[model samples]
Target: MCAHYESPRDKALLKKHFAINLPSELAKRDVWPGYQSTFIRRHENADVGDDAVPPREALLGSFGLIPHWSKDDKIARHTYNARSETVAEKPSFRDAWQRAQHCIIPAQAIFEPDWRSGKAVPTRITLANGEPMGLAGLWARWRSPAGETVHSFTMLTINADEHPFMRNFHKPQDEKRSVVILPPDLYDDWLQAGPGESGVFLRAWAADELQAL
Candidate 1:
């Protein structure tokens, strides 16, 4: 599960890559579970008659997904990553998954623990081409006790025990997992996919296309 990562600082890169315009500055460079960041989702007017609205829109939201039933924001720390296999049944993720509230988290890179050297060392992973990554995620809207609407998101992960590269992370006894990094061409398709079609896009990314340092 990805708990920490670098959100793309260059708005132009986000615009050029994700094709969404952020009206305000990003919340942070480094993002943790409850930290504020940006996510791209299909615009509500995307399929409507509003030609003025873009197909995609970027919004600032918490890194972790906060379910509607959550009483407070603390749930974020534990819901940062949703396991793909159990996402549909997990109370914290099922609603978002069933609703197909898909989103793309724009990240410069993701960090993982490299434990092969006996001690844990943080390793940075990025695309081989050095462009920003579009991490697959689910978003949800929660209404706080104060009547404020809060938006949060969680990255979707897949088991990586058999993956040639991702299997290298985490402890030997622990289950190896990796966040799903979607290909650029499928960005729109993923956002538009319904509950049934969403499952097909949850597979692990190609190892050769990534670089770990």
Candidate 2:
């Protein structure tokens, strides 16, 4: 699974690619499990017939999802990636998955460990076309003890044991996994999909579309 990634930093690029304008001040480009970053999702009021509201909106959220039942934000450290096989049954991810709180994590690249040699080496992976990646994820809201509302999200991952390119990542003995990289055409379909329809969009990306460096 991806534990680190480079979030897109160019405002124009984000606007042009995702169709949302972010704040002048942006989160750190390098995102980690508990770090804050931008994610795109369907606007809450999109169906309310409000012409003023755009269909999609961008917001800053924790990279790791913080479930509503959590006592604190520390749970983020372990909830950063939700396995697709158990996402609907996992306590930390079930609520969001069941509710279809889908989101898109725009990234320039994701880092994974290459264990081809005797030791681990960090490798960067990106789309072969060099465009930003719209990774499929789930978002959730949590209320802090201080009465503040926090937003968080987690990337959805699928088994990559049989994948041509992704099977080469991670430890040789470990079960290979890869994040779901959504195609541009399916962005709206993913965000609007219902719980029962999720299976339609959770397939692995084409290996030939990605390159690792």
Point out where model 1 deviates above 4 Å: none
Give per-residue lDDT, candidate 1, residue 95.
97
In model 2, which residue pairs have backbone atoms overlapping below 3 Å?
Answer: none
Task: Kindly list the per-residue Cα lDDT of model 1 for residues 55-117, writing each as its tens digit.
Answer: 999998898999999999999999999999999999999999999999999999999998899
Off by over 4 Å in 2: none
lDDT of each: 0.93, 0.93
lDDT of 2 by residue, 29-78 (tens): 89999999999999998999988988888999999999999999999999
RMSD of 2: 0.8
lDDT of 2 at 52: 93
- What range of 10 consecutive residues in model 1 has the weakest lDDT sum? 21-30
The TM-scores, one per candidate, come to: 0.98, 0.98
